[model samples]
Target: MIRNDIRALDAYHVPDASGLIKLDAMENPYPLPDTLRRTLAERLANADIHRYPDAAMENLREKIAARHGLAPEQILLGNGSDEIIQMLMIAADQGACAAPAPSFVMYELIAKWIRRPFTAISLDEHFNLDADRFLQVVSREKASLAFLACPNNPTGNFWAADVVERIASDFGGLLVIDEAYAPFADRDHLHLINEHVLVLRTFSKIGWAGLRLGYAVGQASLISELNKVRLPYNINTLTQIAADVLLDHFHVFDEQATRIRCERERMQRALAAFPDLQTYPSQTNFITIRVPDAGQAFAHLLKKRILIKQLGGHALLENCLRITIGTPEQNDQVLEALKELFK
Candidate 1:
């Protein structure tokens, strides 16, 4: 029989986005160029399916590290950042897992699966963290691990560097700075990595979602410990080969991200012009807005074959919808749909 907690938990839901414009998930809207797609196909075709993947993935690690100017020894791979989050929770010292409320949900959900205590420090009305208060809770709860999503999801705003670094310096525990949106952000905090701090990232949002690849950058010893908890052959042979080949052409993804950022700005400006909508400035490829009626707007978009993430149930995010930036045509369609609803 399953544990009562496990039984009581509701399974995570991924709504059917089939036949919709498909902006519910924050994915790169652009597809690989035909040439690159053919190249990747050729590389993947050469992979030996009979053999297990490169468990250590040394070459891939070196390639990823070189991009960040870190050593291969400092890298740890996971099927995706979610797997890495679970590994960190499983390997950390026995104590509470902490994070700011209204941030990523996985930190708390995975902690619960492990039966670890979880603490959420609520953000202020403006969705900003108070560093001093966060540390106070972490210390009082004796939290041994924490996760902070940079340019936080759902809200799509980056916290001040001083605020984040202060928590990293004062907290006596493992701290993960998740930079899943780093490619779209104006800054990164790799310089803060140390014994108790790690930066997590995923290629999913950057256009390799189908590959399910993620990684962590930390001090060599810390990464080594997290590696112990990773499942054997977690990344398959095909994914490994594809990732290795794709990293060589990372400029393609970078260019796509630049275009998304530009679209995000354009979308922000357009959304702000609506008198009934309140838009938050974003540093990621998504924009979150508080609309006059989230339900109405969401339904309107769906009727028009569009899909977006409606983040309800949280007081701070009430009547809010998170819109992933898409190509020019997709964005234009969204604007037109909203205009029809509000007109």
Candidate 2:
């Protein structure tokens, strides 16, 4: 028999979305434009695939550090932001713990897999963090790690900066600020890396999801501890090279992000017009909207070959659905389809 936790655990499900508009996964809808795609193809065309990747991936580290205005020593790369979360749990040396409510799902799942005690501190009715309760739990120091999604997923709202700062100031334990959606958000705690916080970021949302590149920035000592638990050469040669190439032409990534931001704002405003809909203000590239019946809306969109995420099981997320901002045309299609549904 498997471990009791493993047996009881429900595996993460990604809905089959073949031939749909595919907005459910919070993915960037645009493919790399022809020029960049060709460049990436050319780079990989003659690359050495036989040899092992650079253990340190120094060049990629330097590129990331320069982009963030940090020293290379402060950065630790992971296969993806998900791996970075696992590394943080390992670094905190916690077994099992409940994460704050309405955060990224991975935090709780990872804790359970590690057999750590986990509890969720539910957000207030508006899906905002209950900082007071959160502080109380941390002061108890029962769990070794606490995870916060800065611009929280599903809700698509960024926590107030002052609130996060206050928690960092008060909490003595490790605080992981997962900024996977940072590129689209205006605010971040990246400046708080020297504090009791570790900031996790990734290229997944921006344009390089397929590469599985993510990084954590923290005090050198803490990052060193995380490095020990991470497998050597976890990022392969091609990924490192591709990340480096993309970073070198980061303007391309920025342009795409700008487009997505525009699309998100347009979508949000249009969503606001629906009588039965409640659209939450978002700093990330996705919008979370409360509908009269989210499951029905999700099913209706599916029938039109458009897909969006249904926030059914998530706390405080009842009757809500999340839509990733797509290209101008895709956004129009979604809006038109949704208009028909609500009309």
| Number of clashing pairs per prediction, in order | 0, 8
Question: Candidate 2 on 1-343: residue-level lDDT in tens?
Answer: 7898699888889888888898887788888888988898888876788988889877788878888788887899999989988877766755335466787888878877876677787888787886788888766757667888888887888778888888777767788888999989998888777646889999999988889999999887888778998898899889987887788788888999999999998898899998888999898878999988888898888888999998866658899899999889989988988898787
Worst 10 residues of 1 by lDDT: 309-318
Q: What is the lDDT of candidate 1?
A: 0.92
Clashes of 2: 8
Per-residue lDDT of model 1, residues 1-343, tens digit only: 8999999999999999889999988999999999999999998888899888788999999999999888999999999899999999999999999999899888889999999999999888788999999999999999999999998987999989899999989999999999999999999989999999999999999999988999999999999988899999999999999999899999999999999999998998999888788899899989999988899999999999999999965689989999999999999999999989766
lDDT for each candidate structure = 0.92, 0.84
On lDDT, the leading prediction is 1
Deviation in angstroms for 150 in model 2? 0.7
